[model samples]
Target: MNYRQEVEALQPQLIEDIKALCAINSVYDANTVAENRPFGKGCRKALDAMLALGRADGFVTHDVDGYAGDIEIGDGEEGICILGHLDVVPVQAENWQSPPFVPEIREGKLYGRGTSDDKGPLLAAYHAAKLFYRKHPDCRKKIRVIFGCNEERGSSCVRYYFEKMPACRMGFTPDAEFPVIYGEKGTCSIVVRGNYRGGKLLALHGGTVANVVPQQCSAELLGEPAEYEESLNKFLTAHPEIRAELKGQQTHTCLVMYGQAAHASTPHLGVNAVAAMAAYLEKVCPGPISALIHRKLTDYTGAQLGIQAEGQLGALTMNLGIAKYDGCKLELTLDLRIPHEVEADALAEAVRMQVAEYGAVLEYQAGRALILDRESKLIQVLDAAYREIEPEGGEPQAIGGGTYAKAATNCAAFGPAFPEEDTHIHDSNEYISLTSLEKATAIYYRAIEMLMAD
Candidate 1:
């Protein structure tokens, strides 16, 4: 079948499906979590909605205790798989042009929370597979499209699904940039806790998740209004890019700092509000936590922690993704993307030692790096499929972002994001273009055809 023509013909249906899926507000709610719905009501609804789509199209669907679900195209035991997630990172709706859950189309772009991250890409791959199977219904090999609901929160959904199910022959996830991803850096998050005897620094908070650079940070300092206003003004003058304010309270002053948010994998692209606040505190209300954050957390390269390293995949990068201080105790979660050459344990130990010096304790969870050989058949096939779709596309590359590919065997994260386009993923006004959807659908169709060749 002419894949491009088929995808183009189905644009309207595709857009509606994307809008419907994106409308669910599946952000992994902990409040409504239950026995079957492990990721909570929002994610469960998303998983159910996706399964309904598959079942409507005469495909076999399975809900794996709500942690994840799968739609199978055939009866064969093992074949190609398509991995995609339904859960999204938390969003500050006030920053969006429209209600985030209400999907909108502006200038040929579908705007919503999960539109760019994985939902749009997930459905693109789904429609592509649907088209392929519609042409080859009698084909023996099965095509399993897995829908994960906890990808944003450490991919526990896929982890549980794969644990309960069999691994596919090979697959690709539509969760990352175009061309193809052959390698991915290892990801780890370290939890640091420290106690502050100083009464000047009161409550502090920042960030929503451990994978996004915090855009806003606030700290309550026990002091008069006049104590911090002058110094904050001078600091703001020095760094005009940072937006901050001092709100006076009866017994304390609230210092609010604002910065640009970006995916933790590319921390350099973001201005971390937590780090900026630390810098301000280091200057005015100097304390152990502030000094530690200012000295070590400000740099994304792990330079201050003395654990920077680079490998074939990429360099080590870090983000101060979460921070909280409740008057006396401070807690922080630092997300680190480590290259393959650097041992995750060694890196964690180095950070632990550094954090220990400032009277803090640390605990970590390390996810190993994924390195697929460029010369491997899987990479060659995926690369060929991408090149066939876009002749002028760039070579396959490594990314610091972790995806469902890390949890699945014989799979890598393929298209959805084009290098030139900024989808604003993990931020407000996230979107997926109509052009991207059509192109990626065609690419996935071609890749599935090639993978399932007789």
Candidate 2:
């Protein structure tokens, strides 16, 4: 029952795979991906690389069209799927204490883009699965360590994988917060587009991805430079979270504001540069963009805009993540994580109402809330494993972050990030403590054992 010894034993080797995956910087992209790239090329290679490692480690592995791949350990009628992702978020390296792509360890913490997000934890699970393969190769069930190339973008990898393979009898994904997770907020991505009748703003750009709170925003202006410079400075000053810089004279002015970036599900935990820019624009322009944001963009939770929709998980969260304006054409993308009970159209209506002032147009919509059976055998098994680790009764909760579990039934997100530790995933200087990664691997090993053993 004591798995800590096993987890600790794998520490040295698990660090190697975590470092390998982190060094790759397989950020989501089409160029880095090939024709089979449902998500992108870097991800595809990352997927293949992990599967190759699995095969090298003496597991039966398969790569499914560069979308997703699986490594099978043991033989059986039913399987336990340890799901995780090989892809990572695009890192903003300028502020990092260490070069992002180059993995570094300091004070027992591994630092890199994917260190805590998934790669580090995924490797832990990978190593854990290997232990089971060696210990009980003839077990009644199998352990398929599943990883995807596109968990960050569209999860077509998992979707495609499930279509090609079989669902797990029960499983866990180490891709989110932990002790345990009982529910996950619903998730939605919407693109709201509109045309402004040639405003003073030339081009405005902000945000790295729809799932992240924009840490920076930049805008070009066609106004009397003196008129707004003072106001802009005041705006930036009032919001210390946002760093604003001005370039060019008033005629063709450009302003850049830097904020802190974190996952959109917890926007209040981080600052959104787009919000600061919108605040200033609301003062200067009072047009659609400003009004739309004013009405919609609340700090973090979806309290404002009357979108305080809540369900079994928690309050719905909406992030006005990306924004841009090219010569009068304004485009914005929003990320929302709702409960399973919320319908896609209900979310759309809420968004449509918020942006009605902008005369916002819908460009695209994707993802509905996905829910797994909380009382199912998979959850019970995973919960028992988590309980075995933490006997003091810290309940298994839910979250807004999406994970590989969504791709299949009877799967839940498990983890390396303990409830007490914060490794700064998706932010600058992303790191995972050596202690945490080791602990996660052991937990994964035990969880796999209970489900895969006859």
Evaluated with lDDT, which candidate comes out highest?
1
Give all candidates' CA lDDT scores. 0.90, 0.78
Q: Quote the positional error of residue 206 for candidate 2 in Å.
A: 0.7
Off by over 4 Å in 1: none
- Give per-residue CA lDDT, model 2, range 1-454, as digits (tens): 2457766776888888878878886897766555777667677667778988987877788888888888887776657778888888887788699999899999989999898988888888878877776676566676778888888886877898899988777778889976667677767788888887666767889987888888788988776567677888888677776787777874788888888888888876778888878788878877666667765774466676666677888877878788987876778888888788878777678767767765876744656555666677667777787777666646777888877777777678877678767687878889998877776676777788877653
Best by TM-score: 1
In candidate 2, where is summed lDDT lowest over 10 consecutive residues?
363-372
Q: Model 1 residue 108 lDDT?
A: 88
Which digits, one per residue and each the tens of the lDDT, describe model 1 over residues 352-374? Answer: 89988899998999998999988
Candidate 2 stretches greater than 4 Å from native: 1-3, 137-140, 223-229, 363-366
Model 1 clashes, total count: 0
